[model samples]
Target: MFRDTSHLVVEELSRTLERIDPAQVQAFVDALLAADKVFVVGVGRVLLALQAMTKRFAHLGIAITYVGAITEPAITPKDLLVVGSGSGSSLFPLAIARKAKAIGAKVVHIGSNPQSDMKDVADFMVRIPVRTKLYLDDEIDSRQPMTSLFEQSLLIFGDIVAKMIIDERQLDLKGLWQHHANLE
Candidate 1:
C-alpha cells in the first residue's frame, strides 16, 4: 500500500511537471529580474512557498518583501507582486492584486487555473497544471489529499526559479553567503 501511494504521488507530480509552460516561467523570471521591488503573497502552504522564495530572492540581492510584513513599504508602480494561489479566486489575494494594480504595480500570478479571477488583473501569469480545488473533478485528480499536489508543486517551482535566477546572474555560493544575515 505504501509503495502504491508513492508511485501514485510520483505519477501525479510527473504529469504536472510535463504540463508546465517554460515560456511562462521565463516570462515570470524576466519580470522579476526587471522589477525594482518584488512582493509575494499567498495563503496557507502556498504562503510558505512564497516566503521561501522571498528568502532566496533576498539572498540573491533582489529587493523583496512579504506582502503582510511590517517591513513591507507601500507597493508602488515600480514594484511587482508575485501571487501563488491554487484556486486563484481567493478573496484576499484578489483584493490585494486589485490594489496593487490600482497603484500601478505589475502582477504575476502562478496558479493551477489559467482562468482564475486574479489572472484577469495579472500582467503576467503561469498556470501550473495540477489538481487544484478549482478543478477537483478533472480527469487528473490528485492521489494525495486536497491541494497537496498544487502546494508541493508551488514549493518546487520556487526552488527552480531561484536556481534559474542564480544561474542567470552568475551568482555563486560566496556571493549568496555575503547576503546572509550575520547579525543573527
Candidate 2:
C-alpha cells in the first residue's frame, strides 16, 4: 500500500506541475533575481514550503527571509514579497501582501486561485493550478487530501526555480556548499 500510494502521489504531482505555465515560472525567477531582498509569507504547510525555498535561495547567495522572523528587515521598493497560499485568501498572507504593496514593494502570489483577493494585491502571480480548498473550476483535481498536492508542488516548484537561478547565473555548484548551514 505504501509503494502504491507513493506512486499515485508522484503521478499527481507530475500532472499538476506539467499544467503550470513555463512562462509564469520564468517570470517568477526573473523577479527573484532582480530583487534586492525577497520576503516570503504563508501559513501551515504552505509556510513550510516557502521556508524551504527561503533556505535554498539563501544557499544561492540571494538575500531572503521568511516574514515574521525575528530578524526580518523592513521591505523596500526594491524588495519582493512572495506569498504562498493555495486558496490565495489565507488571512495572514493576504494582509502581509497588502502591507508590502503599501510599502511600495513588489508582491508575487503563488497559489491555485488567481481570482482570489490576492489578484488585486499581487504585482503578478505564478499559479500552481492545483486543487485548493476553494475547489475552483480551473484547478487540477487531486486525489490527495486537503491541499497536499498544492503544497507538495509548491515545494518542488521552489527547487526548480532555484535550479533555474543557478543555471542562469552560471554559479559554481561546489561554492553553494559554503552557504549551507554549518551547525546543521
Candidate 3:
C-alpha cells in the first residue's frame, strides 16, 4: 500500500510539473540570475518549501533569504522577490509583494492562480496550476489531502530552477560544495 501511494503521489506530481510552461520557467531563471539578491516569502507549508529553495540557491552562491529573517537585508530595485502562495491570495505574501513592487524590486509570483490579486502586483508569474484552496477550474486535481500536491510540486520546482541555473552558468558541481554550510 505504501508503495502504491508513493507511486500515485509521484505520478500526480509528474503531471503537475509537466503542465508548467518552459518559457515561464526560463523567465524565472532569468530573473533569479539577474537579481543582485533574491528574497522569498510564503506562509505555512509553502514557506517550508521556499525555505528549502533558499538553502539550495545559497549553495549555488546566490544571495538569498527568507523575507522575515532577522538577518534579511533591505530589498532594493536590484533585488528580486519570489513569493510562493498556492492561491496567490495569502495576506502576508500579497502585502509583501506589493511592498516589494513599490520599492522598485522585481516580483515573481509562483502560484496556481493566474487571476489572483497578485497578478496586478507581480512583474510576472510562474504558474504551478495545481489544486489550490481556491479550487480554480484549471487546477489539476489531486488524490492527496489539502494543498499537498501544490506544496510538494513547489519544492520540486525550486530544485528544477536551481538545476537550470547550474547548467546555464556551466557551474562545476564540485565547486558548489564550497558554498554549502560548513558550521553544521
Candidate 4:
C-alpha cells in the first residue's frame, strides 16, 4: 500500500538541479535579459514548456515567442532563440541552432548533452539530464506511452529563472497580474 514512485523522482530531480552550475545559470539569465527579443522552441511536450516561459516573460513586458507562433519567423539576428532540446539529439533543433548561429543570432540550448552538435553552435547551454521510461514514443508519441520529464524540467526551470528575475526587479503580484489573461 505504500507504493507510488514520487520520492524517487523528486530525489532525482533534486540531484539534477544540484548539478546545474550556479555561475553559468546567472550568466545565462543576464544574457537572456539583455537580448532584444526572445524566441523559444521545442518539439512535442517541450513546446508546452516554451509556452510556460512565454507567459512569464509576457508578464514582464519582454518580447518572447515560441517558434511555432505567427511572429516567430520575424526573429532576426539581433534576437535570442532559446531551444529546449532536452536530448540535444534532435536533428531539427540542432539544424536550427546552426542556422541561427550563421545568421548572427544568439542560441541557447537547454538540454542534457553539453558535447552535442547543438551545443557546439549554441551561445549558451544549460544541461538538465532526464531519464525517460521509454524513448521512441517521445518523438512520434506512439501508444507505447510517453512522459515529459524533460518538458516538466524545462517548465520548472524556466519558472525558476522567471522567479529570480521577478525578485531581482522587485516585481509584485500586482505587477504580474497586469500581464494576466483578462479574457480568461
Q: Write the per-residue lDDT of candidate 1 for residues 1-99, one digit (tens) a residue.
A: 999998998888788877888999999999999999999998888999889888888988889998899899888899999988988898888889999
Q: Ten-residue segment with the worst summed lDDT in candidate 4?
A: 136-145
Model 3, 74-127: lDDT tens digits are: 999999999999899999999999999999999999999999999999999999
lDDT of 2 by residue, 1-184 (tens): 9999999999999998899999999999999989999999999999999999999999999999999999999999999999999899999999999999999999999999989999999999999999888888988898899999999999999999999999999999999999999996
Evaluation by lDDT, superior candidate among 3 and 4: 3
* lDDT-better candidate, 2 vs 3: 3
Q: State the C-alpha lDDT per candidate.
A: 0.86, 0.95, 0.96, 0.73
Error of 4 at 74 (Å): 1.6
Q: Estimate each model's TM-score.
A: 0.92, 0.98, 0.99, 0.85
lDDT of 2 at 163: 94
Clashes of each: 0, 0, 0, 0
Candidate 2, TM-score vs. the true structure?
A: 0.98
Worst ten in a row by lDDT for model 3: 130-139
The residue pairs in collision within model 3 are none
TM-score ranking from best candidate downward:
3, 2, 1, 4
